[model samples]
Target: MPIPSRPRAAALAVSAALLSTSLAACGGDSKDDVDLPSQTLSWKDCPAPSESEGGGEPPSPLPGGTEWQCATMKAPLDWDDPKGDTIDIALIRAEASGAEDKRIGSLIFNFGGPGGSGVTTLPAFGTDYAKLRTRYDLVSFDPRGVGRSAGVECEDAEQLDKYFQQDSTPDDEAERQKLVDNVSAFNGNCEKHSGKVLPHVRTTDAARDMDLMRQVLGDDKLHYFGISYGTELGGVYAHLFPKKVGRAVFDGVVDPTEDPEQGSLGQAKGFQLALDNYAKDCTSQVEDCPVGDTPQDVKDKIAKLLRDLDEKPIPGIFPRDLTQTAATNGIAQSLYSKDFWEYLTEGLQQAYDGDGKVLMMLSDSMNGRNEDGQYSNIQAANVAINCADDKPRYTPQDVEEKLPEFRAASPLFGDYLAWGMLGCTDWAVGGAADHPDVSATGSAPILVVGNTGDPATPYEGARKMAQALGSGVGVELTYKGQGHGAYDSGNKCVSEAVNRYLLEGTVPKEGTVCS
Candidate 1:
C-alpha cells in the first residue's frame, strides 16, 4: 500500500459546490417496497469545491504539496438498518489546481486488499497523480477494521506470529490438524477481541461507506476507482446503487458470485497460467532467463523443490521456516506482476541450487513479514476479510474432489492453497450470499478496467463485471504486460484513456480495447 504515493495541494480557491438532491426522486429510498426503475442518461458537469468556503484547515501538510482538510463521513455499520449505529470513516482530500483545469467531482481511489488502507497510500502517491488531482479532489479513507480510523487490533504481535507461521498446506493428518487448530485459534482470538466490529467489515459495508462519503462530499453520484478487492467493493456499490455511479472504474475485478473456495481455486489456476506464460517468456530469452531447458522442465524443477522443502525446510537461508506451502504461495504472489517474475525466476534457479534468499524475499512480501520480524496488518486483514465475506465450500468431499484438480493446476501449490481456503471455515463472522450486481442502470456511466494478464483478478472477471453493469462502459486496456493493476502501471494507452474518460464525460466506446 505504501509503494504508491500522493502529492500536495496548490490553492485554486476552488468553491465547494453542494449538489443536494432528494433520494425520493432518485429512487434511492423506495418505502413502498416497490422496485425502482433505473434509466441511463448523460452525466452533467458539476462544479468544483469553492476555494473560499473550504473553510477548514488547509489540506494536511505533506512532504510535497499542501494538505487540505481531513473529513469524516458517517456510515452505517450494517446497511440493513440505515438508522443503526454509525461509524466515522476519516477521509483525506487533495484539491486540484490551474485556472484552465475544469474541476470535476471528487475522484475516490481505492487500492485493493480488502484489508488495504487507502488513506495512508494517498499521501504517499499523490505526487504522481498531481495532474489528475488538479482536476478532481483525490479522496481515500481507512475503511473499517483498517488503519487510523477505528481499526481492528488483534491479540499482540507474538500471537499473530504464531498464527501466520502455522502451516497452510497439510500433507499429513497431523499437519492438517495443526492447520485447523491454528485457524480456530486465530479466529477464536478475533471473536474474543475484535468480534464486535468483525461482522460489519464485509465488502458490502465498505460500498455503503463509499455512498455516505459521496453524499458528504456533496456529490450527487459516486466517481470512484477501486483495485483488487476494491473492485469487489465497487461492484457491490454499483449493484446496490447503480444510479449513483459516476465515472467509476473497477480494476482487478473480483466476481462476486464466486464462493471463497471457488475464488481461491480460480486464483490458483490463474497463477499457474501466469507461471506458464513466464516460463515460455523466460525460456525463449535464455540469455536473460535463469530458468533452464523447457517450460515443463522448469515446472517440474519447482515442483520437485517444493516437495523437498515440504519435508524439511532448508536451514539459515530465510527468516521464517521455509515450507513448500509458503514458498509456492510466495511464488504465486510474485506472478501478479511481470516485474517481479524475474526475481522469482532467479529465486527458483537459486533455490534449485540450495540458496533460498530470493525465494524467501518473495515469501516475505506475500506473507507480509518485515525485516524487524513483524507482520504487516495485511495478512491478518486479508484472512479476516476473505473468511468473513464468504463461506468456504471446503467439505471433506469438496477437498477430496478438488485436490487432484488443484494438484493438476499447481503441482507445488494446489493442496496448500486449498487448505488456505479451508482455514476460512473457522471464521467467526457470517458470510455474504447476496451479490449486489452493480447495474447502476440510471447513474453516470462507470468504467470497468481490466489488465489482460492480471493474475489476482483475471481479465475475464473484468469482462464479466462489465457485462453485468449494462449501464457501464468496459475499457479493455491490453497491457500485454503483467501486473495486478494496470491503469497506474504506466501504460500510455490505458492511463490516457482513463484520464480522458474522467476529465471529459466520455466513456471509451463499448468493448474498446487499448493495446
Candidate 2:
C-alpha cells in the first residue's frame, strides 16, 4: 500500500527490536484442495543468503549448537491451475531442541515485506524465538516471488540509485510527469524481467503456497507468527483455510479493511505520531535533545531540514547526495524502533552539518541496497506483490484530491506518501482486490498484537483487524510500547501472552493490555 515505505515494505530490519532476535540461519503450494506431491523434505545445512535475499554470511548456529537447515518445496506457479508448472518456495528451519516426544509441530514465521527473505531473516533472529523452539521447530520461508523462490527482478542497482534520487513529492506538473515516468519505467523493468512471475505473486497465491507448505512440512495445521505485512498475509491465509489456522499470532497488524489509498493515508498519520513521540521522548531526557530545544522545536527543525534538502541536497555516502526523499525515508526507517532513535538523532545532527552519510545508509537499508551498491529483489518483489494484490491504481488526480487530507495528517510526511500513490500506476499485472478479506468465522483464535507507538500499521488497525477477523477468531492484545511488533519488544506481558497462547493454547482475555 503506500509505495513500500514503512506503510510497510514492513520497512525491513523491522528495526532493531524485531531483528534483535538471536542471529542464526533461516514454502508452499496452491490454495484450496492442494494435492501436494508426497515427498520427504531433504533439509541441508543452510548456505549464505543469496544476493536477492540481501547478500550476507550464512546464519550462525543457535545457542545450544542446533544448526539451521534449508529446503525448497515446489508449489504451483499459479494456484488457479494447481497442476501447472511449479515454483520453488524456499524454506529454512531449526528443529525443536526439547525432547522429541514433547515437541509440537513447526511454528512458521513471516516477517512482512511481502518481499523480505525469511530464508535470511529467520536465522539472523533465531535465538529471540528460542522459547518457541523449545516445543516447535521454528520455521520461516521466502514466499513465492521473494528471494531464492523465483524472485522478481527489476531495475539494476545503478538504475535504482538514480530512481531513489529523483524527487518523490512532485511540486509542479513537469515534476509530477517525471515522477510518473520514473515509476512507469521501474514497473516496466519488473515486467520485462519477471513478467511471468508477476501475475501469480498475489498474497492469495502465497497463502495457497503456505497450505501446500503445511502438507510438505507434515504440519496438521499452520502455526504462524506474522509481523507487519506478515500479519496481512496471515489474515488472508486464515480467510482461505479457516480450520487450518492453529495458534497464530499477528503482531504489527495491517488493517485489512482499508484499501490502498486509505492504508497509505493512515501511514502518513502513523509516521507523524511516531515522529511526535520521538521528539517528546528526546526533549524530555536529562541531557539536551541535540536536535532541538523543545518537542515542537524538534519537529520544526526536521521540517525545515527536509525543505532545505529539497532546495539543496547534502553530501551523503560519498558520491550519493541525501535529497529530501532519502532523508525522509531514513528518518522513517529509524522510527521503526525506539532503539533506532539514536541513529535518527545522529543522522539529523549530521545532516545539519552537511554530513549525510548516516542518513543515506539508513535510506539505503530501507531500499534494500547494501553498501556495495547491490540491490536486493525486495523492492522489486514489494512492488510486484503489492501491485498484484491491491486493486486500485491511483492517478495523480486522486492523489491531488486527497492532498489536503494527507497534509492534515502529517506535514513532514504527507506529500511524500501521497505521491507514492503513483507507484503501481503502470503495473503490468491486474490487482486482486481493493483490500484483503480476513473474515474467518470458523477459524482458530489468532492473537493480534498492536503497539501504541507503531509508526506503520497504526494502533487502530489492531481493533479493526480483530473485528474483521470475525468474533472468536481474532483476540486483540495491546502493548503500550514503541516499535513495529510487540513480541520482539521483550515486554514481559506481551511475550508471556503470546507464548502462553502459542505454546499452551491459553487465549488471553480480549482487549488485554500489556506494557
- C-alpha RMSD values across all candidates: 8.9, 3.8
Candidate 1 weakest ten by summed lDDT? 11-20
Per TM-score, the best of the predicted structures is 2
The CA-based lDDT of model 1 is what?
0.62
Candidate 1 local lDDT, 1-515, one digit each (tens): 00110110110011001100122212232121222222222222212211111122223454465655565555556666655776767677676664434778788987767666565556556765776776788888777776544566555556755565556767677877777777677778777877778888877677767766676565787888777777777777777776677787776677666666666666666677788888888888837556668888778878888879877876423445656655775677567666666677767877777777666666555544444455545555665666566654355446767888888776655776666666555578767663445554555666777767766766777777766766434444445556677776678887877778877776777666766
Model 2, span 1-515: residue lDDT tens: 24353323235343332223111111222144644455566899998888898887888899879999998887789876767898988999999998999887999989887688888888877888989998999999999999999999998888999998899998899999999899999999989999999999999888887877776777778999998899999999999888888899999889999998888888899899999999999999999999999999999999999999999999998788999999998888888888789989988999999999878888887888876788888888988999999999889999999999999999998998999888898899999999999998889999999998988889999999999999999999999988778887779999999999888999999999987
Top model number, lDDT: 2
Rate residue 378 of model 2 by lDDT. Answer: 84
Task: Report the number of clashing residue pairs per model.
Answer: 30, 7
